[model samples]
Target: MDLRIEQAGDRPAIAEVHRSGFGGEHGRTVADLVDALRRDDPGALSLVAVEKREVVGHIMFSRSLLDAPRRLVEVVSLSPLAVRPAWQGRGIGTALVREGLRRVGERGVPLVFLEGDPAYYSRLGFVAAGGEGFRKPSLRIPDVAFQVVRLPAAEPWMTGTFVYSQTFWDYDCVGLR
Candidate 1:
C-alpha cells in the first residue's frame, strides 16, 4: 500500500472524501470553516491521505479552547475520515490520524483534543484529559467522548469547557441534545 498522508490541496476531492467517509451533511465542513477563517481567524488544519492521486482519507483540525481563560489551541475535531468502503480497515484512517497528530505535536500546539471512541484514541496516547466544564455545553456527549493528548508537556491544570471552532455553532453535533 503506497499510502502517503500530507496537506490537502484539492478542494473538490476534499468534499468528496468528507461526504463519503463521514456520511451526510458537513462533508465540506472544513471548507466552510476555511472560508470563515479567511475573515480573520482561519482556525483549521486540514490533512489528506492520498493513494495514486486519489484522496482516500482525510482529517481536519480546527480551533477549540479551554472554557476558563479562553486560550486558543487547535483541536482534532473534524475527522471527516473517508477511505472508500473497499479500503476500510486497511489502516488508511490510522495513517491519516497518526500523521495528523505528529504534525500537530511538532508545531508546539501543546495539546490535541477530540470526541471519539476511547478504545481507539486511547491506544494512540490520548486519554480522558480534562475537567467537567462548568457547563458540559450541549456539544459534549456521554461525558467520556471529551479526550485529550498533551505533547511535550503542558500546564497540568489545563481544564475548562471546550468551545469548538465557530463553524461548530452551525451544526447540531450528532446526538447532542
Candidate 2:
C-alpha cells in the first residue's frame, strides 16, 4: 500500500472509504464530517493510503485549540480515521496514522488529541488527557475516550480545555459536542 498526502479530486474515494469503513448512519456522519472539515478547516492535514492505485484508507488532523486561562494554544485533532472494510486488518489504517502524525509533528504541532478507544490509540502513544492540567470542553465526551499525544515540541502551556473545530459539532461526532 502507498501512504501519502491527499490530493485534489480525492473526495469521492475518500468519502466512500469512510462510509464503507464505518457503515450505518454513523458512517454517513463521518463521511460528511470529512467533507465539512475540508471546506471549513483549510489548515487540516489529510493523508490517504492507496493500494494498486485505489484509495483504501484516510486520516485527517485539523487545527484545534487548548483554551487556557491566558491564551489559546494551537494543537491538532486526529479524527475520522477510516479504512475500507475489505482493506481492514492489513495495516492500512496504521500506515495512514503513523504517516499523518509524523507529518503533523514535522510541522511543529506540539500536541495531537483525539476521541477514540484507548486500547486502539494507546499503541500509537496516545495517553489519557483527563489528569491534572488537562480538561475536556464538554461532558459530552466520554472521559475515557479523550486521549492525547504530546509531540517532541510540546510546551508547558499546552494544558487546558481541548476545543475541536465546528466541523466536529456540525457532524455530530457520535453525538459528542
Candidate 3:
C-alpha cells in the first residue's frame, strides 16, 4: 500500500475516520473536530494517512499542561487515534504515531501524554506519567490508562491532574468537565 501521512486539515474527513474506527454510540462530529484543531495546544501533530487519496487513518495531538511542582510545562497529548477497520493492524496507525512523535520531538518539546493501553503505547516509548509528575488525563478513568514520555534533558517532572483544554471536555474525553 502506498501510504502517505500529512498534517490533517480536513476536519470532516477526520471525524468520519474516527467514527468508523470507534464504532460507538457517541459518534464524532464536526464541532468536536473543529474544537480539536483550534485548541490552545492544537497538538504537536495532527496526521492523516492516505492510500489512493482515501484517508485510512487519522491521529491528532494537541497542547495541554503538565502541572508540575514549580512550573507548568508544555505537553503534547495523543488522543482519539483512529484507523479504518480494513486498514488496521497493517501498520498505518503505527506509522502515524511514530511519525507524530518524530515531528513533535524535532520541535524541542519535552513531554507527551496519552490515555491508552500501556502495552500499545509502551511500544511507542510512552510510560506512566505519574512517576514524572503528570496524572492521568482524567480522574474518572483508571490511572493505569494514562502515560507520558519525557524527552532529553527534561526531568521526570511531576504528578498532578492533567490540565487539558476545554476542547477535551467538548470532545467527550473520559470523565471530567
Candidate 4:
C-alpha cells in the first residue's frame, strides 16, 4: 500500500471509504464533513492510503484554535478517519494516522485533537485532553472521547479550550447529539 497526501482525484474514493466505514446516514454526514473541510480549511491536512491504485483509507486534520491564557495558539483536530471495510484490519487506518501526525508535526503544529474511541486512539499516542489540561469545545463530547497528542512543538503553557473551525460548527459536527 502507498501512503501520500490526498489529491483532487482521490476525493471520490475517499468519500467511498467513509461511506463504507461508517455506513448509513452517519457515513454520509462524515463524508460531507470531509468535503466541507477540504473546501473551507486551506490549512487542513488530508492523507490517504492506496492499494492497487485505489484509495483504501483516509484521514483529515483541520486547523483549530487553542484559546490559551497567554495567546491564541494554532492546533489541529483529527476527525472522521475512515477505512474501507475490506481494508479495516490491515492497518491502513493506522498508517494514515501515523503519517498524518508526522506530516502535521512537521508543520509545527503543537497539538492534535480528536473525538474518538479511547480504546482505539489511546494506542495511537492520544490521551484524554481534559486530563492533560485542555477543554473541549462542547459538553456533548464525552470526556473519554476527547483526546489529544502533544508534539515536540507543544509547550507547558499551551493548555486551553480547543475550538474547531467554523465549518465544524456549520455542519453541526462538533460532538454527538
Best candidate, lDDT-wise? 4
Find the 10 residues in a row with the least total lDDT in model 4.
168-177
**Predicted candidate 2 versus true structure: per-residue lDDT over 1-177, tens digit per residue:** 788889988889999998899898888888889888889999899999989999999999998888977788899899989999988998788788789889999999989988888888889888889964678867888988888998988887778889988778767783363
Over the stretch 1-177, how does candidate 1's per-residue lDDT look in tens digits? Answer: 444434435666666665666555554554454445434344456677777777777666655665556564444453444665656888887777787777767766666777778887878876775452222335446667667777774555555655665555664443244
lDDT scores for all predictions?
0.60, 0.86, 0.70, 0.93
Best model number under TM-score: 4
Each prediction's TM-score against the native? 0.76, 0.94, 0.83, 0.97
As for model 4, its CA RMSD to the true structure in angstroms is 0.8
TM-score winner between 1 and 3, please give it.
Answer: 3
Q: 73 in model 1: Cα distance from truth in Å?
A: 6.0
lDDT of 3 by residue, 82-177 (tens): 888888888888888888877777887777777788888888888876665566656776677778776663565444667776677766675422
Clashes of 1: 1
Return the clash pairs for model 1, or none: 37-42
- How does candidate 1 fare on TM-score? 0.76
Ranked by TM-score, top first: 4, 2, 3, 1
For every model shown, the clashing-pair count is 1, 0, 7, 0
> Residue-wise lDDT of candidate 4 within 13-45, one digit each (tens)?
999999899999989888999999998987799
Regions of candidate 4 where Cα sits further than 4 Å from its true position: none
Task: Judge candidate 3 against the unseen true structure and give its global Cα lDDT, from 0 to 1.
Answer: 0.70
